[model samples]
Target: MTQRPVSNPAPANNPAPAYNPALSGNPQSATGRAYPNGNPDLGYNPPGVRNTDSAVPLRRDKPVIHNYACKDAAPGNLAFRWTYGSNVAAKNRDPRVQVVQYNEDSFVLRQNVCVHWEAPFTYLLFGNKGALLIDSGATADAQHYPLRATVDAIITRWAQARGRRAVPLTIALTSGEDVAQNQGLVQFAGRPETTIVPKPLHVMKRFYGLANWPSGTGAIDLGDRVIEVIPTPGTHQDGVSFYDPYCDFLFTGDLLFPGKINIGNDRDFVASLERLKAFAADRPVKWLLGGHIEMMFVPGKYYPRFATYKPYERVLEMLPAVIDEAIQYARDVQGKDMMLIRPDFALFNGVSPDQRTQVWPVGVPNINAPRPF
Candidate 1:
């Protein structure tokens, strides 16, 4: 018993062990502790201590949650002044690509009329892992259009804002045959960390996961953001439309816009419009964005072809009611070869190639004089 009571003391040259609240189970003093409020490394505070730093909260007081499963769509802004290019390319100083930030994760880009007469609109959407570019504009030369450069800058800025290193891009087109929309595809070639969907019917079907060519829908998963790809091949055989649930935007491309609807297949055009109407019946569609806006503010009036200047251009965002109206108009002129001009859109069903050169006013026949039969 007397031997057990005797204990050896630490050497005089030895230093004292460091104090750790986690290991030692001791309360840290305010002055000697590295963190004045509490141990920063600890997940929870000691019995009597309060966590002063908000970074590690005691409990979730007001937690914010986003229920993506809900069918309701998120609202966004559409109030923007689009850059309508000048009549003369030499005098036009507008940016080749006009980008409008609809929301935090979505951008609406438009090519200047000076760059291409069509001045098509493109959509860029971001998700957790990557981004999706809906359509390429009408310009191929990046030196003149700067599409790739503009997209690169946007992706870079988005990644930096989200503390990410890289964001992969996927380029898709509404219609592979549309020269006004796919001319800029060449700019994205050979780009690093990019995937361009081949402009072919079979390839697009596989790329978008559409088992049925012109009936069944497909999907493009941009991580958390899933875009519904509907088979809309009325204006063109390879044409497809995209529906974004987040923004509730139905991107109809050239199928339906505030411009001329040149119907490639009359039956398919009507069927596609009916499908769109049914699809939008239950779902809340905020807007039906299209490839281009050729209509003017005046009812059934559009800017002259190849006219770069459009001062009185109509609003680009079309309502879902336009789908019903379009379906009716398309069915009325199902087999006709004349242009049916409406207040919002002009239906060019079976119109001849030469008819495109002539401007048709808002009327049933859409012709000013009798044709030389």
Candidate 2:
């Protein structure tokens, strides 16, 4: 689905709003100002911004951007969602660009670019045996700062980190949402020699057809690390999950998030979550890497605010609830009802009524059980 660009509406006739210096730098003040605990107006403050005094300087050698926009329909509901908090630190603390380290075998490196906003995308360089990248940012408009430069820098840095040698890099998709994979391929295309593994057929056929695309589920075995692609349908037919056995990490593209799951594609969303749960049950998923949020699943903790139910032995634990929610929503409201009640169905209005009828099982009479996947 093509995302409509958020046109920066011209400033209102009223005098320009005063710049909150707190919003810019002061960590404590910014935290309070952005999220005043129980206040409805204050949204979620991005991670690292809450404690600014301890803010680590961004790696200067690389460009970075941070965004803090809430994912829910209600702008104020910031908790458990991902958002941009502050710009990247000016200095390079570690040139290695390790965003999060799961264990001795695995580590994640994040690229710096774009300030916080809707649909923020970050590049993750995963190192197992060889190197693999999860999701590329949207690069439709060259005018947009950092989006282009940020991705380019990451590609360069990733190569350099690998000693600029000819290393095979595989691109994995969480969802084919433009932000996650669009610009990512464009940037990688610049490096002709680098081995680019195409996403699996199940995902690609649904969102983007085989137009100027590569073939097969490109698997890379980098000695100690092995990256394999698994199809995760539901959120988007093209959605995929990456499993790194060396690190025991599962990059759940967009199947899950810290807070609410974006089951915009309801049926697949539930199924995708179920798939992840089943995988987690058998494997050691120490880290649930999210394309959007900094952390989605932290072991042994109930992230109720993010709609995470307990006893999360597998991805299925969250599925029944999400399916129930979507099914209930379809039953509760009129197909034409518009107050934008649910996030999953918000985009429903954007599509044709016929499409809505096809997608939503809600309001349909005698729909006994939830729609089967």
Using lDDT as the measure, the top candidate is 1
What is the C-alpha lDDT profile of model 2 across 1-373, one tens digit per residue? 1112233443478433344545433233545345333222112223233433212222234322222222321121112222222233233232222243332223343333232122323434434334555666544444442343543455455445333444455555565653544554655566544554445554454333334222223344554445655656554566677766554556665555433333445555455555555655665554555554321233212222222112221121122234345444433332433222232222232233223223433342322222212
Candidate 2 RMSD to the real structure? 18.5
Model 1 lDDT per residue over 1-373, tens place: 0011113434469633444544432222324235644443333442345543322222333321223344566656879788877757679998889988887689999999988878999999988778999999998898988988998999887776555677899998999999989999999989999999889889889987778777778877777788898888889988889998888899999999998778999999998898888888867898999999998777776766787887678899998899998998899889878787788988887775325534554453442222212
| TM accuracy, model 1 | 0.77
Model 2 lDDT on a 0 to 1 scale: 0.40
How far residue 279's Cα lies from its native spot in candidate 2, in Å, is 1.5
Best by TM-score: 1
RMSD to true structure for each model, in Å: 14.3, 18.5
Q: Single out the weakest 10-residue window by summed lDDT for candidate 2.
A: 72-81
